[model samples]
Target: MTRHILIGLIALLPVQAAAGTIGKSEQVQACVLRQIDAAAPVADCVNEAQTECLDLVMKAPMASVACFRDARDTWNGYIGDRMAHISATAPTELAGVAGIEVKYDLLQNLMQCDRMIDLTLLREDPSEATEAQKARCEATATALAYVKLLLQSRNLN
Candidate 1:
């Protein structure tokens, strides 16, 4: 899992450098789309989109969460479609194993992010910003959760 995270973080480095001078959503969208051709990890692609989106609206927590909405939605789409895809493609036993693994990933992702949000809310004066932060964190958790399933499915091919 740590290796997966490291690879994902490293994969984003070049995209991040290239995007440093890009300030428009159009440009960011283009760069993210180009990641497939570049053969970057999908986690990197999703993280770049969310990070850049958040950076664009860092001053407003709610707006930052709004920026994350697209990434969150995209990840949700991936998660939503993946199980059926796996079931249809893999041998039944492999599909069942992958299902269990993906479920574990999903649980770990949400629980860890929830832990963070809970910690934030534990502060004496939690506010709207705290809620917004929670939303963004959930977005990020969802964004990162699907990479393992994605890689696993690809190997099934």
Candidate 2:
């Protein structure tokens, strides 16, 4: 009985570390950033946003949920501004260029990141989010990475 209890306690330790206290904020942030950075390339935007949102929750487990809620809204505005510029210019600048399709594809991918952010980050609550939602957020981050890479290739970033 004593050994069984010890084993049970051991099993709970990782969970406690992951979702327990604000003192664990740095650990939580590192874990979340790893998750976001490791996401598969070109994954869905919502998945990326969800992963980030949930990670923020894990980072500040005891902080008010409203902060995360507000974060998404604020982040969406930033992403929206960047996306708006691409949307306004892509149709014109992307025209008749060599490899235009690739450029357009990358542009669309970035725009999808914005939409996914809206659906996952802005609209959802991290505390109650499902695995699927988190997956969408991870996807968004992945797509963002790819877009960044593309932009850098063109000296845009």
- Residues 37-74 of candidate 1: C-alpha lDDT, one tens digit per residue: 68875556555666656675557776666556555555
Which one wins on lDDT?
Answer: 1
Give Cα-based local distance difference scores for all models: 0.58, 0.38
**What is the alpha-carbon lDDT of model 1 when measured against the actual structure?**
0.58
User: Model 1 residue 54 lDDT?
Assistant: 62
- Give candidate 2 regions above 4 Å deviation: 1-64, 93-157
Model 2, span 47-154: residue lDDT tens: 343454456555554332443333333333333333334334444443223133333444465466567656765556654433333333333433344334333333
lDDT of 1 at 13: 22
Candidate 1 deviant stretches above 4 angstroms: 1-43
Among all candidates shown, the one with the greatest TM-score:
1
Displacement of residue 10 (Cα, Å) in model 1 is 31
